[model samples]
Target: MHGRLAKSFKMFVLVALCMSLTLGVLSGLAMAQEKKVIRCFVQAYTPRERMEADRWDPPQYYWKLEQEYEKLHPDIDIQFLKPIVGEYEAWFVTQMTGGTAPEILWRQLGAAKADYVKDWYLDFTPYLEKPNPYVEGNDYWKDIFIPAVSESAVAPDGKTYVLGVDIVGVGIYYNKNMFAEAGVTIPSTWKEFMDIQEKIESAGCTPTSFPLGGAMSNPGSWSVRLLQDMMLDSKMMEIKTGVKGAKGVVKRTREQGGSISWMELVRAIKLGIYSAKDPQWQEQWKLLKEWSRYWQKGFLAAEDTDAYRLYITGKAGMLYDGSWQVKPTEVDSLREFDFGLFNFPKVTEESSPYATGIECPSIGGAGCAAGNFCVPLVVKERGLADETIDWLMFVTAPQNLIPLCNDLGSFAPALKVTEGVDPRLLPFIKQLERGSERIQPDLSILTPQYYQQHYRILQQYIGGRLTMDEATDKLQREMEKGADTLIDQHPEWGLKK
Candidate 1:
């Protein structure tokens, strides 16, 4: 009886061991089937503390989208990899070189595309043609973007690589009370604009705030606004459009050439279509110099933040900045005075080469569209391209985008709004609506190095360190040299003779 009882106990122990082993094997299999994590790296423009505080807010679009996306996509985990402030480009380069780049990354504006576009970014052309699953049924994804934005995103190779999210326009933000106090009317012509500046200055206020310091020493949006005005000249337009003999015009070498076509412009420079010696070019410099006199003393040494502060404090009468400034100026700065928006005035026929009937060309300044999010080529190798693109589209859809735009306050959505934008941003939207269809790519787009060189020259001229002749000659030479280098590198551009 004792032997039989012992045998029964052993049998029970063996059964319990078998059950434990089976459970362990099943758990392992479940773990193997867990969701894949998609890594994204983006430039963090907001402070972490601020983002965290607003994380639960409806307008905290980035965080909100992340939570919603993960909930909907149970099989996927999205992670935003934040780089150190001001060191994103460095970190991005390291990641790209080490073959560990995030699945989605921010495309650095003004960076040389040749450095990464072919090797690092996925060609989004195929994806852009398809309908966005996040959009309402039956609409193509590409159709939703504003026409200029859609067209601008396409590369010379006809591939769409970047998807911009917002439209930012540059305009004057003037202190309403200061303008009223000075009795200055909103200017309608270049002369009137300058005259208003003088009037404001005489009223004991700095006429305008201009910044030309920082890493690039960029002369802020005002300078670009001035350039856009100058570019509206009929001769400049003709050169950009490839029209034959509209004053200082030239012929195009290729059927694809237009007045503003990148290659055409490069060819025009190389072929001497128009030089710095041209009367139109000299006039632009003269106008810029004249405008400089009305700026705050030592304005060239001031940074963007300095200039912004001056205007917000009511020390300066007008600030020429991008639409992105609206939120910061009105809400963030908590200014005491009311401000009004105005387009840079029309360059009168007396001051410009264009015909009398031509109105101020709607110049979409530098940040016409917010920077885009691009999928790194490595994401495709890892088989996450579809998922990454889908995620981007989901975030950019109207339902998600509107809240983001409302929160930011400055940028208008790149997607057409069936409903109105944030009321605060309507003024900017109105300006964008009035913009000329003849969009000119930022000078940085063609050659960032040359663009910087031109800015440096402009700073010197503005500070009275260089004569207009010296500045113009140097600009033309630097541009030509940069064009030559680019042509050599991109022979397919058809810019070389």
Candidate 2:
């Protein structure tokens, strides 16, 4: 009778243990079901393994922020979606139209151009004015970011629609060993810059891997745009206010920087200040043609990757690229030479009489940044908008931003969070502060239709297929038509009846 009782007691103990384990599993499942899901599409910041290229060391820090946020908010689940494949613009449009967009997406205000006006994106103005709970001593959400970048987030409609977490700037990435071999140093003026390139070419290396044609027209076009802005520096205030001696026009401030209003751009175009027929405009193209002599052979057809290959192989002395190149270029295993970056040299009177001697400001502005997250208007219906924004605020807080920026090693952080930032990004940060708004806006973006024609005309002129007179005539006609179409479309600008 004693043996039977002991055996029965052991059986009861095992049954109770099994029941406890089952109950624990059920509780976990219930918690998961109760948690709210916030879908995110982080573009390049998506985890490397999700993108299926996981060989790189030092995992993406975005995941760390996601995990930390989850730990803090047990009731919420952050679901980072895979990076979108194919053309981003088309894919984004489809998602929005289908009402299937992630709650949070990597998009800038200018991504779709019409999305803001169509009310597809949420207006963030109200939220920006509020303090971020995650940030200590945060008087307002906007105050924590770099002043210029923060201010620039406001769209022309006077509303913030995107949160730019990091800023990007462009500079010349040079092969340091090649520069040493050529006995040249960084150039401060356009004349000196040209001379250095000549010396580098004399040393039997391609001076620059500048692509102007095919799918990579930005580098070549950017050079022209910078020079044009430099030439027009003296006319900035006049163009900005639409009058030569306009007073009390309230010069818009951007921290230590400045920017032209969209209305002012329309006024300038209507007043013919931005006419392509102007001699200054023609001179910019001439300067581009002159600079083309130092570019790698077949620059007109070279792809961006081709330019990168040339520079990395040490056959080219310099490559004009953005801050984004620092990551892959620095980590490349096959690169044998060290590299350094310097701002594009200033255009001075020596290069052209039209040059105002006012150096071209950095091309990047508030609108120009990476990790720019935007929320879809549809997220409100899905009951995820609040949680989505909360996550954005958490990640953008300086404490989290520092690690992400350091790990990305590409863009400069939009916030004032500089502690522990990657040392390679220091130069970019210094230059970004010195950069003011461009006096001349990029016409291609402001007027998309004319840009295609403009690119073609530039290619013809630069490749020796069209004369300066021919190119300028075609460009003038296209520019005038483009301006008219833009004015007509925006009745609020008062440029059209």
Candidate 3:
């Protein structure tokens, strides 16, 4: 009787242990399903903006992220809200400032960041101080990202607000067929670059094409590409290298280090004339009327889209564009034409590197969040802030860089990667890797008023409205006036002239 009772007791104990294990499994699954969600908002893309839902469709770049986020946490959702056509800034101001905030919102960290950082954004130090138990040490917070990314996101009080997922700037895109046809070895100096354009035109084809608008064409894109010229000639780019938000008005390469004063460059600016009637060239300017006379008939009337089609059609020899010009592999002409790329030619020495013509990334205004992100201080107050931080680190992980670059169809930033990127990009990337680097901005980031003033002055100079002396004086005066306002508003920006 005693043996039987002992055996029965042992069986009961085993049954109880099995039931406990099964319940534990069910509980774990339940917890997995209980993950959190963050709603995000962004401004419309320029391509999308230009088309305004007429012909172009929204890109599915964020689709992959949405799916991945959902998979990781069954309970979490990332519903992206894109602002209306041309009303992005207006809508964001209305909705965000109106107290209808997104859980995990993002925007450019420009002048607005300086304004928003005080009250608009969150402080991530609490989450960053310690590692999440589920994940390994927070290497991304400590050291993985490029210093520039960290600088834009970090506050003076030691809080991390936003992480730059990528860098956006324009570079010169060329045609391999055109290069071969011209019999010109890849030009290293600014003169060589121009000579190629002249050769292409001489061969009865356009040397290059770009988009220009308003009363005139603005060469901001051109300037940023050649900024490295100033970087190599000057110490500015090197000084600000890897450091975010460094006060930079102008940086020149060693060859350019005061070689061509702003005044000198202004004088030479008229020398590189583009023809406005060559609508074949989107960025065609009227200041160079003689250059306009050189183009073939019917070239002046072409719109930006038409010009792009012509280049892709291979009728035009070379196109001066950015990664944006290269559509996906599905686009027939883009796939067919093997495009070559070079840094925009420098203003002075060919050997001297190019400095991009654009400036001041991370400004908080304009409302377009694509290629940029901003985290409001409101999100930090939530319990799920940890997850929000995780999302950023994951999004910026080097693994995602290739996919993002492939989607964007331009050059990728100089981040450490496992394998190689697109071959067409290899040459440009190699140059950037070896030489000095600077981040240039596209039109979306620039202050329209400021840009207009600069444009009018440049137009006047090129059109002979302002002499070189007058142009320099205007630039200096404007810079000083603007500098005082900028300095007073954000002393941290180091905008002192």
What are the lDDT figures for the candidates, one per model?
Answer: 0.67, 0.76, 0.47
lDDT of 3 by residue, 358-391 (tens): 3212111111124455666566566666667677
Cα lDDT over the full model 1: 0.67
What ordering of candidates by lDDT runs from best to worst?
2, 1, 3
Clashing residue pairs, candidate 2? Answer: none
> Ten residues in a row with the worst lDDT in model 1?
249-258
**Alpha-carbon lDDT of model 3:** 0.47
Question: Model 3: what TM-score?
Answer: 0.64
Runs off by more than 4 Å, candidate 3: 1-36, 42-58, 116-118, 124-142, 151-159, 215-219, 224-307, 328-330, 334-336, 347-369, 381-384, 398-405, 408-415, 420-448, 463-477, 487-497
Candidates sorted on TM-score, descending: 2, 1, 3
Error of 3 at 204 (Å): 1.6
Better structure of 2 and 3 per lDDT:
2
Model 2 lDDT, residue 174, Cα: 91
lDDT tens per residue, model 1, 50-144? 55433222224577778899889887888866555666668778877787988877763224244544466788778878898888873678777
